[model samples]
Target: MARTATHSPARVDGPPAGPIEIDVRTRVFTWITDRVGVIAISRMSAEDLARARSRRLSHNVVTSRVFGPMPEDVSLTDLRIAGPDGPLTLRLYRPHGPLPAGRHPDEGLPVVVNFHGGGGSLGNLDQSDWLCAHVAARVGALVVSVDYRLAPEHPYPAARDDGYAALCWAVRHAEALGGRADRVAVMGDSAGGNLAAVVCLLAREAGPVIDAQVLLYPVVDLTFDAPSTTAFERGPMLTRADMDVFRTNYLGEGGDASDPFCSPLRAPDHRDLPPALVITAMVDPLHDDGVAYAERLRDAGVPTRHSDHARAVHGFICFPGVCRAAGEALAEICEELAARLA
Candidate 1:
């Protein structure tokens, strides 16, 4: 089986509140990241960064508490399927909760098709194991995390296509996976967040309808010129340059930034999409991405919920052990998903 899984110095709660309230600890951690990025990683060549990332992943999957063994009630499995480009992987998480005696994964449970954040270039199945476990255990819904193709090679539509394929696969094989085809939702963080939204948009033509979408600090706008992007130029984890790297890597040269396939916020119509829960951290450069998307979702008559974790930064979902806010946010997101899916 495979598994999955912010910063912040502020709350991305879009309204009813005033300015950006920075979290002192989040500021400290982000300042440290900024320093580290300056002193080391920022200077590395892309090839070197890839090498370093692989090395880190080797240790992260083992040492990360998020990647640790699943809860006693949760089970995991790793599987592969045919895709446009060779074989694609999916890590499935199932919880032994209150399923009817005759029902099993081979029968069906509510399912969430998850895509991970890594700017569409760096994430893999193992990176999401922890989140998958927590989601499966907490929600009692089958969690299927897709390992889609990355960018700088695969480019814009590749990840999107792969994501769509995974959704179709999840829906078509839902009964066999013990998941309900009618209750499948799409969720992602960052780049994956972008994909989650794109999948919903793309599904307007595709056969398997998406039930809902959960976007966490997604890259809704590839333009990366939003006010929040400028304000959070130097991040706790994501910087303006970091976004440049992600955007350029994902789109490559001369790709249309305005293409809704690449930037969901740029999408002309938010009208008939599934309900959405948009989560953002006040300190993240992409915070406005979630906020803007939610605003439009509401404007277009989509049932939507927006939450800003005060005193947080981007990527908090990966650091539950270090930040109490991260753990709380993760639990809250899972709860919302469970309720919506139910």
Candidate 2:
């Protein structure tokens, strides 16, 4: 088993309270996107939602620029695995380069299983190419990015089940994927972050030991009652109205928001989970969700680190080119994963 680090008191790092200061480049980027009406899923019709998903916004030229190109030192391959509902597509990332002297190709490398942020409805594997590839190269880990089933058509539990299934698959095939089975981590952003947290909780009671978790601007609570949800209700990127749409689409008619699997923040106990690095954006309505989750984990004696980026907006990490804080947060993520997985 990978060594578990000592529990650390949850400490938040960011600017003191004041008006939120979004980065200038971020301001300009949002202005252009808003003018173009890039994606307002809250206002989109069912047909429009289907069209948007088909477009795969995350792989477009503009998004490629914003999210940064896939690192040259990483190679990618797509494969299918059995998920709870059906077959699921997964993108595997491996670093380019020979093994270190005296080290076997399959030895010591860590594994990172990633889920992309799409509010349980919107994203795909292509959206996570940059982050997964970079982590593969930077941390010398095999990065498996899951293309989980979406909501409305699939609804509640579908995405979450796919997430846990992928994590189990990654661990089961770690050696074949050129990674150590014992050194594994789960990572995601936004709704994907919610999945990552839920996966860790599931693994704690079941099996497949996860060493670490990285949640970027995660939506841990579906209650939508966090103070930040009201404070930044009209987000520059992710608005409260948009969240309502996501909730309705993901939960469908009778889904429960308070379910521990749906809202990991509402879990009965947060103890015995993997260590975590929760990143939050000051301008995001889900900001308090990350803050509160980190506190819950820390209070439960789980090693946790909370980072609040003052100049970032919701999903800023996906727009690294425009968000300076994205790069800084990426460094923090890489460093944390490296240490925990090592």
Candidate 3:
């Protein structure tokens, strides 16, 4: 596949400078860094980022691979939570050791509705096992990771609807699941983050109110091409090329990328959305997306908090066992939501 590179036309504004190591094995990264300079990634337009990402997908096989197994200390159980539409299965992770009562008590435990990220194409409960376990245990919340339908096969609002359905299901059955429906919060990373953010908007519009939201490196905008997408177009983990594949797979035919459901940043209003805890990475393609969304939320009178992990990259939250930042970020998420619910 051919590669294109361009110099960044904008001023550099990001975390303190760090080492830039191009992945020659993935020539796209090497080529991008060599031709444009690493800073260009954070400055280039979205179209360029999308084009570069398309090239990376042609070479890299995006898969579900974690650094190591999730912490074994947390216990996980799978059950199908009944949704408004029907029975939607959920993987519940309880941080506390064996249930004192076969199930969590109704009052104290909080519930986190987790959505896994894979550009809306790949990712599942099994892949999110560790992250959920840590969040469940660390936050003292009952972590309910929803296995929403995937893209290409499922596409666009299919996953979004399933996510909303699962959120509704979790809220309705929080007590039965050993948590409080009143204290339910929504969360997701990457594509899942996109869905989670959309859930907040959808809930606000419908009144199924969530207490808070934890958006980890979320994809909030589909239309405005941010500079981050171009700056970090190719590198370890997520690549711009992969993002192109994800977008294509997710939108499919006759899909509108500008739809707020597809890109919450496009939404006219961020008001009425639940309080949000937005976590972003310093060197990620989607970094600015999260930042922009958080700002919009705050502007709209929504209580919003944001943290940028300067050293980490996109999806760093998923590497809980390996990346210390992941666990700490999850803890921050729990702290914010826990306080709000408490």
Candidate 4:
């Protein structure tokens, strides 16, 4: 008989002020993230994220200040590996807290390779630290948050190439990273989700398919015709206008929006792709893209789960402490992956 052990539940403390109670935490983080909406590209170039860091310090304390409010205990490190084009940078976040040396439950664990959401810009592992910690602890997996090259400088296939390269690196070096290559999964939110989708597609086409993929509020389609696009066209975390700019810079001129690599929703076929866990935030503009992709997968005879987090917005998967929806979504993804891969 396979014996199963139970662990204590993870608890969140001191939420922010808001009428809406999101996931496990408060509205505090959202308030901060909203204020720091994408800074002008000019400002980012003029000054190297100094201004962004200042804002993060003011209200984004929990995420900005490392070692402060980190879930219980965790180990974090920055790693650089070679990608298809060039060097690939990533942040390896793992939960090794409290438990003594050899007592660590997941000493040798599987890895969830993640990509941060920012419409191909404006995000890093630091911004998604909370969710990374939660996944590492709850799923007992080493979470490698890939910091792929962003848009404008590196467009379309560049991001995809980098993401796939990172995937290859993770698999090849999983043993050294204390993870199992055979059990690797790819995950992302929003634009990052888009990358994850393409990564899976390309991986299947090229062989070495990943174990699974988890996409949250993903922008699977470059065309903006989804109902959620109009539903959340105005004031929200992610706006349609913002998406336009991201796509322009990400695809550049001469880019093919219909290319399955750029838009997995337009893939010729999804059959034989690894099982997927697709999540869409109700109020997100990209919600329909996720839905349409899931439906396509079903049509193509691929196992997929489509879920919508009602009353949520784009890229909520990483705002763990403040967005209960995000936490729940992450838990669902991890649970499903564990069952499938175990």
Better of 1 and 4 by lDDT: 1
User: What's the TM-score of every candidate structure?
Assistant: 0.86, 0.92, 0.77, 0.81
Least accurate stretch of 10 residues (summed lDDT) in model 2?
1-10
Which pairs clash (backbone N, Cα, C closer than 3 Å) in model 4? Answer: 16-26, 22-324, 23-323, 23-324, 24-324
Q: Candidates 1 and 3: which is better by TM-score? A: 1
Best by lDDT: 2
Q: Is candidate 3 or candidate 4 better by TM-score?
A: 4
Which pairs clash in model 2? none
> After superposing candidate 3, which stretches have Cα over 4 Å from the reference?
1-73, 81-87, 97-108
Q: What value does the lDDT take at residue 7 in candidate 2?
A: 38
Taking the tens digit of each residue's C-alpha lDDT, what string does model 3 give over 82-171?
A: 554567778888775543343444455878899988677666676677667766765677888988876677678788899998888778
Query: In every candidate, how many clashes are there?
Result: 27, 0, 7, 5
Cα lDDT of all candidates, in order? 0.75, 0.83, 0.70, 0.70
The TM-score of predicted model 4 comes to 0.81
Judging by TM-score, tell me the better candidate of 1 and 2. Answer: 2
Quick one: ranking by TM-score, best first?
Answer: 2, 1, 4, 3
Deviation in Å, model 3, residue 96 alpha carbon: 3.1
Q: Candidate 1: minimum summed lDDT over ten consecutive residues — where?
A: 1-10
* lDDT ranking, best first: 2, 1, 3, 4
lDDT of 2 by residue, 205-260 (tens): 99899999999989888998877787878778877888998998899989999998
